[model samples]
Structures are given as structure tokens and as C-alpha cells.
Target: MGESDPFIQRVQDVMNAPPLMVEEKESIQHTAEKMVDQQASSIVVVNEKQRLHGIITEKDLVQRVIAADKKTGTAADIMSASPYTISRRAYYYEAMSSFLMNGIKHLPVVNEDSTSQVVGMITLSDLLKKQNRGKFDVLREIEASSSESLADVKFAIYEVLGHLIDDGIPILHIMKVVTNLYDRLIRHCTELALEEVKEEIGSPPCDFAFFLMGSGGRHEQFMMTDQDHFLVYEEPAKEEDRQTNDAYFKKLGEQIVYWLETAGYKRCDGNMMASAPGWRGTIDHWEDRIRTWGLRATNENILLGQNFLAFRWIYGSEKVRDQFVRGVSRQLGKSKIFLRRAAELEKNVPVPVLDHPIRALFRVKKEGMDIKKQALFPFHHSLQILSAEHGILGETPEEMIEHLKEKRVLDEPFADELLYAYEVVLHIRVTQSWDRYKLEEENSSEVSFRQMKSRDKEALIQALKAIRSLQTKAVATFGMA
Candidate 1:
């Protein structure tokens, strides 16, 4: 049931040999005739350059053109614009899930080459013919459920983790799936919370955005992760409006946090949640605060800047997030002192190893080694400092590393080595968290090194060495040492 299952095969493996494609401007009648001639149920619509544009299905023709009696319409008019497409590299289960989610029978498969051109087509019939009804059926159920609580989805996520881990998938890719699903869950929670808030106190007084910071924002999160959120709304014009907006947003934040806890996502122990008054405010106020942090560059302020550098919008208006991001970027451009302080903060924090005999390499406690503070944070903070120095802002560590590579701030080989090292640390941390999750332990970052295999311990040692190299690079870059 693991790797032998045909359902786990790539979508391209089961897709039709050649995709039936039609130009977007082709007449609906012409498209229909082409489909009929080819015995195809759907036609992928492409642009002049042969890139994916949309799709035209037989159902779309009958419903939109025939039903409306618009016989003269073109495929562009009747086709579903920007239709959901699966990558040729994606698994059959993912394509199947996409089909269920979009309620579409035919899926256009696109290659990941330079043009992202259409390659083939897959259908519900094709997937059903080979897919195992076991795990894939469970995924479909979890997706289609209407339950308010995330308990069901949480279990489903764990099931997916087990399958992926057992299948020998790379840790980096596994964590990507984990974080993506969790982000979607958080967005759904926000949607539900907003609905309740609207019902109770009427519509929001202004536009607002919800953001994730720390590990979740960095997309470095795995099992046993907690919530670290930020909330910002449009400035109110009047005192009365301000009062109402504050109350509405505060209630919304509290409700969402409560729901997240109920669904097993723990609240941040440091009180960094949006429910805290310090973390929720108008967009201008948040911008001013970020500006102040950059100008001051104090030890405390530098810590705050480090955390805020990981900010990513989870839900709400992109404009709001973009404004804040631009402000941060501008501030970084002008604040060399702040960048220097951030570089200084990259120094390691020595957390004592509690149970493990090998205290030199890792900081272990009751749960185990402090993977985050010792391993992840050193590399993360170093990259952030370098990014700020170059006036580059990245949402994830990988992005930051790539930017550094592209900017020639770090040699390609060194950047590549750092990336590999980061992945090694992240993979071990995620696997450890999965183990703790099986024991129903509280969300924690520490892992016991005594339990690890010799090869894994060796890998951890190598990663720590890579982090030290990065730290030296940061010091030299910022003249901090």
C-alpha cells in the first residue's frame, strides 16, 4: 500500500498520451467539432505561445453556449477562465483531490518547463480506474467535510504525514505539504471566525489582514507547532468608528485563537498572538512601529525586528500586507545600524543539554535537543541579517538563501551547502516532532539525541558546522565581530 499503489503515481503517468488542445479564440462550434472528432471530453485552451489559458469542456459548451443559445460564441467566451490545472510532476492523489475540490471531471496537466506548456489531460475516470480507495478516499472525506472544528482534518494531516514519511519522501517536501495544509486550515479558521464576528457585531468597520510570524510565517513549521500571528486593519476616520473597529477586531482575534486551540494548535507562550492588544492595530500604526524599531536598533528592538522579518499574510487584503512590507524594506534600506545589531544577534544561545550525553553539539532538555534555537535560529538569523544588509526581504529561509545566491552575496557552492544543511536540520526536527505527536506530547522543539541513529547524529553535527560557517560569514559581512 505504500509505494506500490498506482494511486500514488504521478498524474502524467495516467494522463492521456497527448492532450487535446484548442486555441482560446476558436469558435465554440469548432471546439465542439474538434472534441467530437478526437473523441475527447475536454479541450485545453492555449494562447498564441501555447501556454495554458483556460479549458473548454463538453459540459461547458452544453451549459453555457447551447443553453444560452449563444451559438456564435468563441471558446474564450464559454471556457472556464484560469481553470484549475495540475502539474505533470504532481501525484495522482493530488490531482484526484483537486478534481474533488473543484468539482471538475477533466484536469489539464501542465509541464514545469520554461513555458509551463500543457502536456496532457487526466480525467476522473482515469484516476478512479487505478487509484486505491484507501488513503485517497480518506483525503477526499476530510476535504469534503463541513465540520467547524479541525480535529478531523488534524488527524487526516497526521495520516498524510505517516504515508509520506513511510514512502521515503524528502523531509523538505514533507514539511512543505505540512505547512501548506496548516496554512489552509488557519485561513479556514479565520474565515469562520470572521463570519461569526460579522453575525454578532455586523460587518467589519474596515479592511484588515491576518499575518503569521515566526516558524509558521517562515514556512519552516512541522508537527507540534504553535500560533504566532499579527493583525492589522485600515485606519478609522472617527473616534466612534475606531472604538467599534477595535472591539470587532479584538473579538475576531480572540475567537480565531480559541478555535485554533480547540483544534489542537497551541497559542504562543510569549503572548505574540493577535489577541494581544500590542500585536493588533491599524496599518499606519504597525508601519510606524516597524519604522521605530529600525531607527532605534536597541537589543530589544532588534529582537522584535528579527521576528517581524518573518511576517507573511495568511488572510485578508494583499495591499495591506504589501504596504507594511514596503515600509519594512524602505526602513532596512536606511538602517545600517539596525542591520549591524541584527547581525550581532546571530550569536548562539547556549541552552544546556539536560539528558543527552553529547552536550557540545546540541542543546537538549526533557523533550530533547533544542533544534530551533540552537540549529534553526542561528542559520535563520544569519540569513535574515544578510538579507537586510542587501535590502532583500524573503518570507522563507530558502527564498532568502536563493536571493543571496542570485545577488552574489555568497558564492554558489557555499549557498548550496547552506541550503542542504538547513534541510538536514529541518528534516530531523520534523521527524522528531512527529514522534512526539504520536505520544500526544505538548508542542515543543527539543529532541533527545540519545535516541537518534549514528548517521542522524553525524548529520546534526555537520549541520551545526555549516551554521558556524554562516555565522562567521554574517559577522564579516556586517563588521560585527
Candidate 2:
């Protein structure tokens, strides 16, 4: 592509057309000088062949070196390694999507011919400036405000979503942006809770991990659904210490829940919030609970394990989360009967459509088709069972698919097909949920077949078939068929 290419206003047109190069071994001071000389916000570290090594941004320098009072280090010492990169041929929207998905400011534009060759750099700020200002402004407002302003920002989000839908952006992409925003909102609430707790009780008595379960855990959540979370903390050494720690963490968890509810997040109906005593516990207690659940092999236990295992840490210590994951995996792996019982749970999810086209068209729409209960559940539930049996806890559906494929638990074309089907179903749910929001109704997977376009109906029917196929494989693999 030449400088005067027709797509002059595109990302390809402006992305480091000449390329800014820096050696990985160069001193931070030297890199700083180069950035200043070029009037650039970021400097790309590259080797002799122009292969990208990492990137050093102004934020990285301020946070890692300057804020930490470190005066000496190579660019490699502070640069963000294995940074997100885009091809020079990619469009500006693709670059913007990457920025939102990865939560990164700067991205290196690489050569299309050779992926490793860095050609230019782009920032989210630059891309946003070039794009339409309306939706981007909503994102900016949400990011800049905290709980005090979340309600107003949410109003803006609704407007943004309507605009995006009207513009015909894909449902999956819209959900991705919405999910990212929710993650940020959760973090902001957590921060506020932490500060309040600190003021009440000098400091945390011990390390703890706060995590979300269910859709939020899987990174698939779109709307402001009910929240499900739990807490895991290090076991205290003495009786008095244990009591002190419990009191502090319990109060902290309550504060978080309260703040989240205040910010419009509905509390979990199952009482799975960290504020609940059952969901807040020492690491040893959590391990014991998992061991008991595995031994019981009961329906409720399996359901509980299903929700708990699909968790993502939001705050506090990583070690606590890691230890809990290993413990749950070990306990579940030791029980063969538990795996089979869990796999059998898929039989409970009713198949809402048939493979035969005419029969599918005649499919009943009682309370509409629950995309979650009837479509996504079979796949998510079955995968959760397989993951538990294989001791593969804490993986998203996509990650689980890859792991299962690698283990020969599922084969090629089938795996790809299933992943695609999963994406389609998720997209349908988001679109349906958006429709509900537009009607000022509750968001749910239950969208009427009558409401869908002919193509959407076809896609939904195909998704049902895919779920059925996976359910068959799941039961057979676990000796439940």
C-alpha cells in the first residue's frame, strides 16, 4: 500500500507508515529521547530483522520506572512484552475492536507479509478521534466515572447500544464491548469497597480472592444480570486470628455487594454472593466443601460444582484462586461416579428444535425459546462435566473446546463446528436481549421464534442441532449414554 492509497483515512493509511524502531537493549532514557524526537506516544522495540520484541509506552514508563523510582533499566525491563498487534492491511474498526477487547492503549501495526515485522503503531485515543464521536463518547464517560455516576453512564450505554444495533454492528461485537464495560464497572465497585473496608479495619487481616461465577465468569455476560460471586482467603493461624479475619472479610464482602446493588447490579437469587457466609470462607473450608460435593455425587452438588468451577478472579490474591482450583479439580477427578452423574445432567436440558427443517419450523415457542436454558445450557453444562472429569477447572467454553480437542476428547471438524455454533448462539442471545431492553422488558434467552427473521430462525435451529450433537458426544464419553 502506498502513502497516497485511496483508503488514506483508514488505519492502514496512518499506522506507522514509516515504522518507529527501537532496540530492546536500548536504555529507558534513550527510548524516552526517541519518543520525544518523533513526537510519538509509544516506541516499538524491534530486533535486527525488524521483528517486534515489545512496546514501551508513556504509561509504562511513568508507572514502572518513574512511579517506582527506578532510574536505570533497558527498554526490555519495562516494556509490555507480547503486546497485541494488528496487520497493516486491517481496517480502522478492527484496530478499535482490538483496543476495546484487550484494554490496551497502544498497538503495533505489523507487516502483512511477515507477522513479526513491526511497521507502525496506533493508539486507542487516535482511533477514537477518527471514528464517529457518539458511541465513543459514551465509552469515555463510562470509563472516566465511578459508582456515583454509573446510573447516568448506563443511560448513555442504552443510547449507544441502540445506535450500534441501528448501525447493524454484529451482536457478538456489541456484547464484547458491553461485557468489557461491565468488567470495568465491577472493578470500580471493588476498589470503592476495598477503601471503605480499609477505613473501618486498619488493613486486611489476610490475603483473599474475589471471583465471579456463571456468565460473568465466562466473559459472556451482556446485560446487568444478577451477580454470582464468592471469596477465598488464606486460613488464619489461630482461633482468634481466624475470627478476626472472618469478621473483616465478611464486612468487606457485604460492602461490595451493597455497592454493586446500589449501582444497579441485581443480587444473585441463589445467594451465591461473597456476602453470604456459605460463599465466603477460608481456603481449607473451600477444599473440604469441594471434596464433600465430589463424594456426594448428588444433583444439587453437581449443579453447585458446575457454577463454582466456571469462575474468574476479579480481585485480591491469585494464589488463593489457584489453590482453590487445584483442590476442586483433584477432588472431582478422584470420583468416577461423580463425573458420570454430572454428565447425565445434560439429559435434563430439553431439546427445543429438531434436525428436520419442517419440524424445526413447527417448533413450539412456549414462553419463547430460551436460548440459555434450551440452547447454550446443554453445551455449557456438558463441557463443564467434561472439564471437571479431566480436572480442567476455570476454563471458558472456547478454551475448554481447545483442551478437549488437544486431548482427543473431540476431533477437528467437529470441534470447529461446535465452537462456531457456540458463537452463533451467544450472538442470538445478545440480539434477543437487546430487543428485550428496547421494549423495556427484562433481558432473557427466551426470544420468540416469531420475532426472529427467517435467517435468524434458521441459525437458531442449527444451533440447537449442534448442542444436541455435543450432548450425544458428552454422554457417550462419560458412560452416561
For each candidate, the alpha-carbon lDDT, in order, equals 0.77, 0.76
Tens-digit lDDT string for candidate 2 (1-481):
2211211235677675576778988888999999899988888888766688888888998999989998998988988888889988775645765676578888898878987887678888876665554435555665566667866666665665565566666555555555656776777688778889999886888888889889888878766778799888989978779989999989988988987886688889889899999898998888777777767979998888778877888778888879878867776767667667767777665465645564465564442667787777777887877766666778778889899889888898888888778878887787778877878897666777677677766776787777788887778786655
Instruction: Score every model by TM-score.
Output: 0.85, 0.79
Give me the displacement of residue 428 in model 2, in angstroms: 2.9
Candidate 1 clash pair list: 368-447, 368-448, 369-447
Best by TM-score: 1
Q: What is the lDDT for 10 in model 2?
A: 53
Which candidate's lDDT is highest? 1
Question: How close is each model in CA RMSD to the real structure?
Answer: 4.0, 6.1
lDDT of 1 by residue, 1-481 (tens): 4643443468777889689888888888889999999988889888888888888887888899878889696778888888887888887767877877778898888886633488899998777776555656545644544445366777767777777777777877776666766776777678777878889988888888899888888887665467788898888888778888899899999988876776677888877888998789887677677768778878888887788778778898888777767766776777678777777667544223222344554553343568888878878788888887777774688888888888999899898889888988888887877777778887567867778886777777677777788887887887655
For every model shown, the clashing-pair count is 3, 1
